[model samples]
Target: MSNQKIYQYLMAFGHFCSDINQTALTALLPFLIAIHHYDYTTAAMLVLVANMVSSVVQPLFGHLADKFNWVWIVPVGLLLAGGGIAATGYTSDFWQLCLAVMISGIGIAMFHPQAAKLVNLASGLHNRGTALSIFAFGGSTGAAMGPILITASIALFGVQGTLTFLLIELLACLMIGRYYRALTELNGGSIKAKQANAQATQQDQWGAFSVLCVVMFGRSIIYYGLNTFLALYWINVLGTTETVGNTMLSIYYTIGAICTLFGGKLADKFGARNVLKCGFAVLFPSIALLAMTGNELFASALLLPMGAAIHIVYSPTVVLGQQYLPNRIGFASGITLGLAISIGGITAPILGKIADIYGLTTALYSVALVPLVGAFLLAKPKD
Candidate 1:
């Protein structure tokens, strides 16, 4: 309805499009392994490459956005992201597919810091948590949809059917491109507001921020560990169909989206520190339960809380990171949203290697141990 709303939604949609490709690569791994006869390590390496590139490079993009307004990155980033997904099925070479996925990762990296900054600019103080949640909710939804999209596309026209989602990305780009002028104007006011806000929060608490980063690192191990291996665990361990395997993955992400959206409001009410503490409390038993169970019903039940616990901290951490280093807002976002998330992906290969040697359940159960470490990191927020 309003200009800011439109811009926020546009940025959110850009996040959706960019992230869909990242998760799609994960969903496609079983199929890739089947067709290429690749080992678990090799299949997971694709996730590693895409995530590694996006994670390592996101802070660079964040600095650029901080120094200069880069609204154009939204549409351009979406195009690169979608184009990479479209090209995936076209390539047979292992290295070529890796390159394509890495292109998608770069697009992901390009979109996030700028989009995050845009959302912050558009939302202002009253609804900061809600706005970040909405932005991240879109991404969680994109990840939820990835398995379904990839599965259907491959089923319909083989792997090349990844082309199916290109039109949607194009539409999103056109919508954003049409209003870049308005977005630029929006940021003019936003920058002034942010500067004032940043000045007010100059009581920087680097010690707490460092602890928070550790908290994020632990969560990533649990979150990405499951994501990288969930589908295969279902298919290989539980002997489910590809559809069934993907449905399980989708369920976790879909629930994750809901929890993250609500988690922000919860964090606002409870304080981010308390919210994170509760989330870590749930993380241990829920994930351990999910890992140990063989029955689909029990697994699904555990997944709901595990998903909720992991994501409940998502928006809170971002908000906290920004609060912790208010003056270096861009770097805070880069480390919190981008680099913290990337940490999980970076370890996906290691998790895959663990799954290779120790079995998927063992690898994932190892993740359950991480939340205890996160719980220990929780402390009183520096008001």
Candidate 2:
């Protein structure tokens, strides 16, 4: 393969490693609830804490990435991400668990902006959507695998099985370290060169970006809602085994991973805004049906369309965000990849509360409404 392809794959591998830890936390939630006797809101708060920290720090990290070449953050962040989740197994208090999760969140925050900045530089303009989709695919696949890995680990070693993430991350760090020089070389030169080039280009379109943010925010809520509760929905509402519920979750993410790549190619062909509109259009009905359905076979069948609708917009949004703010690619990436996405986690507790007071079915129905709003926003004249 060419150096560019190799570098993209390497970065994608890093993305996979980083995201596994993020999803690992989600996968661990049921176990946490069962083992610790925690309520729904308390368990969801773990996601909140992680996303809150990531949402707060990712922009700062992205700003730093814009100013300097922070290539070293990748491996360091991977280590911390893996290590933090591993520490979760050992925590004795709620505060301690939150602290460990916070560390993982920070590590995740550190990885995205810099890594995405490098991916953008490597892909250039023509194949950006495809390249980013590949990168996103890796994370999505890792997300798919996370539940299986964690659940299998727990089956074998109990909660302490989270330590497996530490070993996996260490291996990823060493691999990335080995390729450290190649990664910098892919940057084409110093951050100053990139900044100078950006300055000479089209200006940032704040209005368009604001609209994109709304689109992304809606997508985030739906994505996190399904991700956080799908397994529980299977277990609690559908009367499936935990193993079966998590397996369905794995299938959901695996389908999303495949669609993520397909979505990028579609974006390249049809235009990002069109792809964004198409995704939300499909998403609204899919989620609405998913909420309304009670049959296990039917719910499982819906995952295919639901996964496609949610992930089809993934790379397109990221690419458009970068295109909209050409001069602030890293910062844009931080917002698109980190902050806008994680902001949904801020609502996790609220969803948890809804689930607590009403039901998971009602909470999911609420999630279905978000995409309708996104579709309305998308129907507006181009910004």
Candidate 3:
């Protein structure tokens, strides 16, 4: 394989490492509630805090990446992301837990824009969708692994098991550092290419971009809603063991990972917009069915199509966002992959409250409505 391929894969691996911590905290939610006797809303507050910080800061980091080479932030962010989550197990105070989660959020904020910018640069123009799909695949796989890893760690070491992510991220940072030169070279190429294309006139489509952001926001709601509550829904509503619940979560993300890879290829063949529309169309019914079903075996079976519907749009959205704002790819990435995505986390507390008052099923049914709005937006004339 070429050096570029190796570097691309390395970036994807780094993404895997960074995202492992993202889902790890969610996976630990049950443990947190049981061990500390926290209520649903309070436990969901941690997700709110983390995503709030991440959503706010990620754009600034992306703007900074656009203005200058900030490749070093990648490894540093990885370290902090891992360290913050790792500290969660040791904290007993709610405020302290919030602070720890905030730290991880900042770390995540620091990592995504620069890393995505580098990946875009490395992939060049031809196969950007495929490259980004690989990147998304890494994140999806890490998300899938989060529940299993945390479950196993907790089984062996109790709540303190969160430290496993620290060790894993440290190794990832070292590996990234070893390839630091290659990454810088890719960034350098991006700079040179920008200079060369200084005379080229590619207009930014803000109107369409705005519409896309709205669609993505709706998608984010569905994604984060499921990520935060699916396991709880399984355990509480379906009368399953914690292990079974987490296994269901793992299955959801594992299928999502596989679909993300193929989604990119399909986008490359068809069109990103077409694939995106199909995804939203599929997502609505899948989520609606999931919300209505009480049968454990059938609900488990639904994860296959549900995971596909959610993730099939992942790479296409990122690629389209960058295409829309060609000059500010990093900033576009921050909005699409970070802000748009993390904003969904903002609703977790609200959903938790709904789940607290009404029920998990009601919260899930509420989540199911979001994609229909996304589908409506997609049906509008192309921006």
Q: Once superposed on the true structure, which residue ranges of model 3 sit more than 4 Å away at CA?
A: 190-200, 375-383
Candidate 2, RMSD to the unseen true structure: 2.2
Work out the TM-score per prediction.
0.94, 0.95, 0.96
Span of ten consecutive residues with least summed lDDT in model 1: 187-196
Candidate 3: C-alpha RMSD after superposition: 2.0
- Supply the TM-score for candidate 3: 0.96
Q: Report the candidate with higher lDDT, 1 versus 2.
A: 2
Pairs that collide, model 2: none
How large is the C-alpha RMSD of every model relative to the true structure?
A: 1.9, 2.2, 2.0
Query: Could you tell me the lDDT of residue 113 within candidate 1?
Result: 77
lDDT (0-100) at residue 207 of candidate 2?
84
Ranking by TM-score: 3, 2, 1
- Cα distance off (Å), candidate 1, residue 232: 1.1
TM-score-wise, the better of 1 and 2 is 2
State residue 8's C-alpha deviation in candidate 1, in Å.
Answer: 2.1
lDDT tens per residue, model 1, 1-383: 97777877877787778777767888999889889999988988887888788888888987887777667877777887888888889989999998988888888788777788777777766577788888888888888888888998999999899887676689888888788887876655544575555556567778888998888888877778888888888888888988899899999999998898997787677777888888898888987887888888787777789778888788888878877866656667777877778778888888888888999989878878888886556556555
lDDT of 1: 0.81
Q: Candidate 2, which segments miss by more than 4 Å at Cα?
A: 188-199, 375-383
Candidate 3 per-residue lDDT over residues 1-383, each given as its tens digit: 97777777888888888888888888889889888998889999999999999999999999998888778999889888988998998979999999999999999888888888887877757588899899889888988898899899989997888898889888988888887887887786744477327413577778778888899989888888998999999999999988898899999999999999998888777878888889988887888888899999989988998899999899888888887887788898989889989899999999999999999999999999898876445322223
